[model samples]
Target: MSDRKRGSHRRVSTSPWKYVVATWFAGVLAAVGLGAVSPAGAALRSSLGLSTGELAWATSSITAVSAVLGIPAGWWIRRLGAHRALSWGLFVMSVATVAGATAGSWGMLLGSRIAEGVGYLLVFVAGPVVLTRVTRGGIRSAALALWGTCVPMGLAITAAAGGVLASRWTWNRWLALTALGPLIMAGVLTAVLPRLPRAPVQHPYRAVGAWKGALRLGAAYGSLSLVGVAVVMVLPLFLTERREVTPTAAGTLVALVCLGSAVGGLAASWLLRRGLALSSLVPLGALMPVACLPAFSAEFPLAVSGGAATLVLLVDGLLISAVFAAVPAAVSRAEDVDVANGILNQLGSVGMLMGPPVFGVAIAAAGWGAVAAATFVFGGLGTVLLLPGARTSGTGTAHGVARSLDAQDRVDVGEESEPLRKALDVSRPNRNRI
Candidate 1:
């Protein structure tokens, strides 16, 4: 191997706190761009003469690409390294977003959105893997757990900001303005983030067992995601249509629900710090929606219903963070994190694609009660799928692995060399951990 390739795996010897924060911020920017389309959807349609169907396509373009190419994207991250992949992703997002701003036709905007999807995939797949590599023990758990909030947090922020921007500016202009965030973030990441080590360039699909495990985990996580997202997406409409709430009031309630989710992610980090088992948390999270959603659909006071929805969101958030924390804990080798995350992202895309529409259909067929029943069924299925993987030895304890890595001074970033690989083998928990 060339010197560059050999040294590519070596990370900076210092603590990774700063880089973790930096990378997280970059991921947030990408997420914001991912979400910007929703709040601006109306403006986009008016400005570009897009039909509702075309607008839906524009918004979903990102998830479609992710579902199709998630595994390959993970392999790309492994080959290119997280830092480089993220930088490139940010650049692509920035360029695509800017191009979207200048689009005169719906087709042009949709094309830009498709490109942005690929960029979004790269950043999401690589960001957590890099974060786990840089931090150790409690810190790693805390960081990854907190990372789970990026989507909700980003969506909430962009939805609010995009609404304000859409009122004052054309959708294209608003899009152009949003593009600057990723552009600046890309530059900052290129300058500040340390180079990550590249994994051996191999086809991820060849590892049948690993792929199976990853897909199972993905199904669990995806199911949970589907329910959570579906509820959040429809909450406003449900309140307005079913309860006669004002649009402004419904929007505020939805915002509160999203906020609760963000807080729940932080709470999960606290639980991990206190050494709660992920297996237990996963089941609890699944059960929350089953219980909360039906109660939320009951004829309670508006305030009471809103509170119930917020609680459901909180539990959903907690579940998401716990599942993410389990990722590093479940994988036996550090190198596997990227592929594992890839499978997770791909399935996550599937959930995102299915959730809103499925819930919408149920609501149309019956009512909010039907939506509640659907959430319960999906939530239960997710719990069943996750329980087996959650039972893996050491899957509940991130700090234990962190301690092992710290003891060997192997917490720094790099692809696993033979010596380091052997060290990890010796230090790893029971082989049954995965």
Candidate 2:
């Protein structure tokens, strides 16, 4: 290599992690954009003269795009390449949020939100696949696990920071403030993330059968989201009413619960590095909500109920993070990663949409106890759906995860293709500096 080329390689290799950090922050910013209107919703409704229905539409319009167009978004990201897709997604969100800030009518706000949703969809699907491409082995898995925390961390930022600030500012200022996150992230990403080459993907696409396990994992993710969102949506209200706490105190508690969830997610990185099978962790984490859901929802004492709620979030976070960390491994071809995430994002969007309504209906009809039953059914279903991945070594499809990070021997991809063992032939850190 020429001296110039070698020096360039050295610079790229020295801080490749910056790209990962910037890309991950873009995901968090996308989430912040989604939840921005939520904190200042009352101001928006009052200022724009929006009815409850209109406000609801404004909030959901973005997620609706995610529900309907996840696969398309995934393919879109694939075509654009992860770096371009991420940059564009962040750009879209920044623009849409600015438009939303100026929107005087419900229709205008709704339109902006829809645009934001498209951007949000792209970010969610592209994130995991981008991490897959950028990092190697342990770095890749760990980054993906941390990616699972984006939603909670973003929500936490909005709820803790956005919520407090909204009370002091007009809704337009709040919207303007929210717009800054994505805009800054977009700039950072462009500078930090060099144009890394994509792996050679087969044209006219062979290996169709190999990606089924990823798709199945996505399905299981949908099932898990159905129950997980329900619990998350209701927990604060549950605390407020059942424990006789103030709404602010309840929100604080909910934030603390999410912190616990983040801990669980971060722990997965450590566990995965140690060769723990991801398959075992998924169901084990899911099962806690089954028991804790009912316990919390029942007419238990405040301490018991609070403890159960905390347990549910922590364990479910572990489960969700495991699934995300397993996502790259779930596929055979490196090219399939985005599409698999798209399916997962799509189904997960559907579940997120249904959760609030489902929990509301259950609560109205059968009281608080219905969510427990719902958890039992959906959590069980999620477990069963994940079984295809679990057939190896009594562990789930995460067979490829925690494999030899030392690069001695790549786990044989063909040994078991059901949940997948991964073909670790993607770009390695040592192979090319950039």
How many pairs of residues collide in each model?
2, 4
Q: Write the per-residue lDDT of candidate 2 for residues 190-217, one digit (tens) a residue.
A: 7666554443345535465766777777
Task: In candidate 2, list every pair of residues with a backbone clash.
Answer: 279-396, 389-396, 389-397, 390-396
Highest-lDDT candidate: 1
- Point out where model 2 deviates above 4 Å: 1-16, 198-211, 290-303, 390-434
Off by over 4 Å in 1: 1-14, 202-205, 290-298, 393-434
Q: Which pairs clash inside model 1?
A: 9-197, 9-414
Error of 1 at 264 (Å): 1.2
- In candidate 2, clashing pairs total 4
lDDT of each: 0.75, 0.71
**Candidate 1 has what TM-score?**
0.86
Cα lDDT over the full model 1: 0.75
